[model samples]
Target: MKRKILAAVFLTVTATSAFTGTDLILAAEKTEETAVQKPDMEGIDTENTKIGISIYQFEDTFMTLYRTELVRYLTEELGFKEENILIEDGKNDQDRQTEQVEGFIEDQADVMILNLVHASAAPQITELCSEEGIPVVYINRQPDSLEMERWEQEGIQAAYIGADARQSGIFQGEEIAVTENQGDINGDGEVSYIMIQGEPENIDTQYRTAYSVKALEEAGVETRELLAQTGDWSQSQGQKIMEEALDEFGNDIEVVFCNNDAMALGALEAIREADRTVGEDIYLTGVDALEEAVQSVVDGEFTGTVFNDYFSQSYGAAELAVKFLKGEETEPVTLIDYIKVTQENAEEILELVNS
Candidate 1:
């Protein structure tokens, strides 16, 4: 008999729900079903099942840490053989990623986990995987609208697991609002700020910026749009933009809200070149609690940041794939929770990541 897979929306549940009774035994812990059901692993033929992961790029520290932890947990912790996992890097190219997915399909991979470089390119991959009866799980980025609608209709084995970019932005903005800026020139209770955005087409950029603007407005912070440039999630690009902003706004710029940690680091470089001290002369905020970002927070370089928990994301996606393969039910959209990381909690976060 063919396995019957299920899909349901349960936003309040956690990632631990992806295992089954057998999985619990293997995991050596009885996880609560109220959090989220674990993917059924019975009769899965683990030795034969193949899983493919397509990521944007492994150059970034965040992606590297996640990939390392995921491989470790999935192979060592979950008892899957290392050879069964195939990882492909897109080199930040959408076409290349699509081709990689095609190759995975041709190889008859049982499941494909994709972190799309371009959301619009997702449909072709989804359609190809669907035609071959292979499950597709989207992570970190939102797929295009039409593709999402079709995936729902086709009952595809898919789940979205990532941070709510908008909410993360709101949190960043709230941090900036309360940050005292002694560098303000006029001392009129207003501060100048610059935004370093991620890739132009990235959905996170739009949502994060929008929610940040909302929070800034609510806090009555007068922000000058000195520089709103796309960093392409590149540290070098961030450095260039920050340099330009420094040349334009000088010490008048009190805050820098970067879309990710790399850009924030770039901004830090620019600030350093200008002889401005971070955390003392100006406040810096960024998303993606990369190890460097956490370290920076502990070192007093940044004010704070939001943690996307990439390890949890990978484990959750793996669990979801197992569940889909087992004919178990899951939600179409599974957004993971995010945590705020500040100096006060940096040690705890560092411990978690290190652990």
Candidate 2:
């Protein structure tokens, strides 16, 4: 993992109004005398607010689905003007995301929703938005420790909305352990697992891998980290990494736990090249219950996956942005729940995704 450096001198503000939510913590800075307070809006006009949605990248199919759903809901359901919503793809580049954020600030966007590439990079953006009095909402990623400290100091009206990444990992790990223990399709009583991680600095990868390992340990499964490599959420990178894992571990691998479905597909190709049947010779699991992954489950090529409700996360961010623009009180953090998808529930999961 790459080491991230924190920024210095974030904009500081003080909160005068009291709020409560598990998703965020509110604190006031001593220097500021007066702070703007917004009332929670159960009903208000949301006709002309401009929102900017900045994503880390658009490379993965699952992310594309998320983006599509967000745009659809914002336009069709929320009645946000098509031109009012700005969508920027960072292409997985931190520098690009920074530039895009600065541009959004210059455009004077009503609210900015971010899925940051690096947690530390948030302080600068947050500081800028704070100075401009624009609320920033984070989705799918949380601010790093330093950023969180600065957030409280700045009295930033922000929310961290996304699935519990560590819990998602634990769910994936538990499913794998249970299946292996039961020897449902015949197992050797021992499981050797490989993890295809996401971006190196991504919080999701860290938490998910940690909890997944803990779950496996608790289950008494002899798990080995056969290959731990950064996929960077690129299918090409996933394919390359899985190819190397295949060359090294080959048939001894009992389970392959991928961070997302695209990489899971890539790993599937590598398994095919080795002439081993997936879900038979070796089971597979992934996060981001993407279309292809769910389809693979229905076809018996993979075992299970975790579903982070991207639609609800995006929708909640948009709703919060509208409220914030209207000077309404909003939580600093809002966490969305995740679901585990297995072959038994693949059809239902697919229906939800499609709907």
Candidate 3:
């Protein structure tokens, strides 16, 4: 089994690394402020304010934590009535999500939190809410910048709140780039990787898929594309696709890159079943430091993953929503930074996820 001699490099997290690109955006200590400091809604009146949450897909691993934390913040921290917080699953369908937004409008929701199923439809969705005079706070998935600008021109109150996805991709790539052999599984002085993507229309998927490879190449490692396909961010889909790739590429498959941890978990199952050991004969990587995926990293089952920081992201969304509800000035786009997760801090990451 090949192992990374540089594995200990990141034992103590730092602002920079040997593989960091000059263009890469630096992560800030705002994560400190994001994790702690409960919101002070002392003067805010949420007595009858209705907060309608529209999730892109409830089955998604990361979104589940997001939605849970969002509700927890609203009720527990902000002292909002549980009955006033209405959440609906978009089920990954744009039309269904549109209908949900329409319902929020007709129901006269005080504010709406959106995780757009299709970011391309942000204009339509935003227009729907705008027509009804409802303020929107987008989370996780960001709408097009043009759409946002249009809203600003129309004097609409809307903003996108989430971590920069390009950063997540960079972190994902850095994990493999810093790994031993540069993730070169075949020992041929090159890396060959299979990519499991989420929905192609999703901006997060596009950035993660692109920047991950860009980061690898920037590290002076050559990569051969084995197979790159969408798993729709589903574990079953990930397992099915991995099974097919194994049959097609066999041992030539050196690495697996999943856009999110759910798909990575699925690929891990298939890889273990096929007797291809990760961090050994083969390697795998993903985002969203999910508990199972983080534990796998600790157990040396995965190369690494990026910690998506659901706690901070969820809180940031709620904070923006409160500002919207209170008619306060909020930034047009608030970007949070992501943390790279490896075996070095897997236990700490596991605590964050499990807690």
Candidate 4:
């Protein structure tokens, strides 16, 4: 085992130490503050503190950016050494993730941040880490509420750091609900749309799919699902699904809701190839205001997207890991809110991402 004493006695006072579970749950207020640069954790011997990060897949556009930010924050911002950070790609396989985590524990990593291949595996992973006294920070894919409850009850050094998917879902739906015709293209008195979903088991997929429609209904827009299929969070899958749906539903498919920007981009390609014009005959929305997606919104090609705020999420996760390593208390769940990106503010969002 390796450790280092704090260079400044007060350096151990972490920002998150003052936050309670309830306070952290209301994360929107803390977003700007959390995203600001902080003192590097050089006082704590970052060179000796091993950090383990496991991503579901590097192929995911959002996760790729997320993990990149996470590593950059840990190393450049927080002063962790390159050799001390270990990242593994699960290749979107549960068994592969399990194996990598087991290896991390075997190597006695100081902390682990996981974007699980399967959120259902949280209980097992938490148990393994807790037994070894290694703190775990779960991100992106959220585990069930009951699993979080277990962590609180047991006082485990485990926390979940991510955005509330429902918020993102509501943003996705409201984007279309506020449209000139309220997404009721062709004056059919109903908004018939296609849902391009990610993984079926992902909570983000479930909420984004359900709440986007719920939001439309809440805004008095009658909605009918023309087609819904799992795109598996792939660009090709999204394009294929959209092409098939367009073939069957044709002009009746008024709006398309994709769970993330990658799928939306693919869906956009399919729509253009089908000779359908967005904002003229159809509308589209997605989450994760990726640079391209935000640009599309600015170009009036995409209806809108929900900004996932990887900067805050990744920074928050790294901050929590530092807190745990310092023996500080952390909220079992820390939720960062999502932001809606529309054509009006898409340029600003694109600037933010680039900056």
Top-TM-score candidate index: 4
- Please give the lDDT score at residue 346 for candidate 2: 79
Give candidate 2's error at residue 86 in angstroms: 1.7
Write down the TM-score for model 3.
0.89
Each prediction's number of clashing residue pairs: 12, 5, 1, 0
The better-scoring model by lDDT among 1 and 3 is: 3
The model with the greatest lDDT is 4
Question: On a 0 to 100 scale, what is the lDDT of residue 135 in model 2?
Answer: 90
TM-scores for all candidates: the values are 0.86, 0.83, 0.89, 0.90
Q: What CA RMSD would candidate 4 show?
A: 6.6
Candidate 1 minimal-lDDT segment of 10 residues: 1-10
- Give per-residue CA lDDT, model 4, range 189-286, as digits (tens): 99998999999999999999999999999999888988889999998999999999999989989999999989999999999999999999999999
lDDT, model 1, position 150: 70
Per-residue lDDT value at 235 in model 4: 86
Q: Residue 57: error of model 2 in Å?
A: 1.2
- Candidate 1's residue-wise lDDT over 38-124, tens digit each? 455677878878888888888866777767766765676566678988889988888898889988888878988888878777777
Question: Any runs in candidate 4 off by more than 4 Å, and if so which?
Answer: 1-43
**Candidate 3 wrongly placed segments (more than 4 Å):** 1-36, 40-43
Itemize residue pairs with steric clashes in candidate 3.
Answer: 4-180
lDDT score at residue 159, model 2, on the 0-100 scale: 64
Q: When superposed on Cα atoms, how far off is each prediction in RMSD?
A: 6.9, 10.9, 6.5, 6.6
